[model samples]
Target: MKYDMTLTEKQNLTAYLISIATITIGGSVYNFAISYFLLNETGSALYFSINLAISSITFLIITPFSGVLTDFLNRRNIIIYGEFILMLSILLLFIVTYFYGLSLFSIYIVTFIRSLFNAIVNNAFSASVSNMFHIDNLQKVLGLSSSIQSSATFLGPILGGLLFGISSFELVLFIFLLLSLISFLFDYSINFELFKKENISNNFITDSKINYFKKFLDEIKSGFKYLVSVPILSTVIFVGVFINFFNAGDMVLPEKMMINVLDFSPIQVGIVNGIMACGTVVAGIYLANTKKIENHLNVMRWGFIICAFITILIPIPIYLEKHFQFNFLYLSTILFVKFFVLALINVPFIRIIHEETEDYMKGRVFSGLGVISSAIIPIAFILYGFIYDLGFYFLPNIISAVIIILLSIIYFNPKKFI
Candidate 1:
């Protein structure tokens, strides 16, 4: 791989980093904002389950189309457009909350729109990153990007939590809206010439001439067919699906663990999540700078194993609290350790996905992963909720960990089904 960077490439890199940072901040805030609002208003696990299910469905529906558009359009322009739509969605949420009461139905509608934009924006961002860097450099770039995203993740929740604590949800929406506008501006300023040059070889004109709906269906089918042709890609998507399914448990588990088990406040819960984000930031930086780590598939396999270990270990604090009446410091320490391990594992897993897929197919591969992962997440969320209600909160993690471990073993063994 070439190491030389042109002036224009440097500019594009700067623009891409800023755009991603702004978008991550806006997106992270929206996620925390909606989940917090719904938890406060409906005060039911079932409502949270339903909200997640709807969001997953929205992503499932939009991701394939977004993936196709990523290939056909200028990547930077696609990202800018997605940011504008996301900004509009935030404004709509503000309008609904200001005029009408914070009704569950209203929140659901706003969140669904936001989720649609999120899917598009995410696909665009991933595709843009793939377009910007070479395959060999992808892992490092992805690690750096993940770090930036993790930094946003660290800030967004803390900001959202503080704003929600001090002012109304409407005020938080106003802040998110302002941030999104900045993001839109940043996105618009990015040059798409390099992306256009790279994609000129693609038959965009002929592809664009097809009927929209039929084209969408064909694109979706083509993405799946492409994945099937590549054994590694298929395995990677399956791994991602399982990883996301169990990871959804994290959203509901923290609240349950804090309130019911540790008897902590919302602020404490926010602190814990912030700590996890900080760990992510550290892992991202470490992975980005480490140049000699070339065995991405093996790295990913170990990441899964580590993540599963952390997942299974999470219930230890609860067990201690129940049987031995541990202090808050002890419990928090355990949770923080678990989060740190999770962060360490996730950075490599994501790097592998970014590095393995070809640049042209990145959009479809990631979006296809999104579609499959989203389809499974709804069921996972609902199932976790039900099992939580049944006093079996640990069961989901235990089952998911076992499944992941088995899959990882199979994935590592070349003789097994690749």
Candidate 2:
């Protein structure tokens, strides 16, 4: 369906999308710069990892409260004000580094503060996108947004690398400040009041005469209650949690498998990563332009089945390379194909969140999603690292495949979900 908007409204929508893409790209690069700065300043790889852990902990602490606030407040204003705050933070970084000389502790403080508020902006902005684009074509828009974001996963690092090498710290910080201000201006043009419910009887009072902490707990509980009421949403989040949990070892396993088992060189590993990225872009573009999917959940089930089959094949290369001398590129081919299937999984998953979630509750839902999706990575990494050291190298991968296949079969049946 076409967008239901006047010319000016369409223009405003386009600007907001551009703002989202711009902010995402800028944020990605900025994150890379922070890591780069820390590594250079501390001269210790362990310090960089420590910084990441601190940032992750901060995210975990602030995300739940931010989700609640997004639901309570104005989304557009949150986005606008949030960007300005980010811009000021960048400016602070620039001044601190240029004048007093940057320290590891100072960088940590800045990153922690920004990470807390960035969680709010992320949740509010995501919910706002659904509110702004309520038509059936939300999938297409989300596809394009994903493509733009995935571009950052590749482009942001390259840009950050070049800037880190070529420019002064102040110059790089200035660029982020400029980008954040630009995003703030674009978001400011959008009036979020149009998307909010104004006539509600529960205007933050009459009902909340109980204890403050108890009321807060109840408000948070309402999100879970709503999720329990919707089987599809609960199932989707469950699917994300398990799949992402199993996939955590992926960060270490692929590199280990490529270098140790297949005996591939560093250059070959880089080429394989490039291919995976190319697959993401191609899949995102295909979904963005393709006709609407009438059976999103059914396709998602098939996507899971296909990925499960691919996962079974991935470990085959290790066994085969020792016996039959297949082409070394075989691993790359399988990895590329796997990511393509991963892209397939995203289409229905994003569509379900956009379509199934209620506008009023979207802030909480997206925030809750952020918490659930991220809450597993560290545990999975530790668990996988433990098992990978037990000499049963492929055991984790086997368990991963089995879990995906069983989840697809047991929980995500076509008849049940559809």
> Best candidate per lDDT, number?
2
Winning model by TM-score: 2
Q: Which runs of model 1 end up more than 4 angstroms from their true locations?
A: 1-7, 30-54, 91-112, 164-171, 192-211, 243-254, 322-348, 354-356, 393-399, 413-418
Q: Show where candidate 2 strays beyond 4 Å.
A: 1-9, 191-201, 205-211, 259-268, 322-328
When summed lDDT is taken over every stretch of 10 residues in candidate 2, the lowest stretch is: 196-205
For residues 140-215, what per-residue lDDT tens digits would candidate 1 score against the true structure? 6666777898788778777777787888888878877887787777667655555333443566446657677877
Which residue pairs come into collision in candidate 2? Answer: none
Tens digits of lDDT, candidate 2, 226-316: 7768999998887767876876666666677777666777767767787777677777788878887777666777777777666666666
- TM-scores of all models? 0.82, 0.90
**Model 1 residue 182 lDDT?**
75
TM-score of 1: 0.82
Error in Å for residue 307 of model 1: 2.3
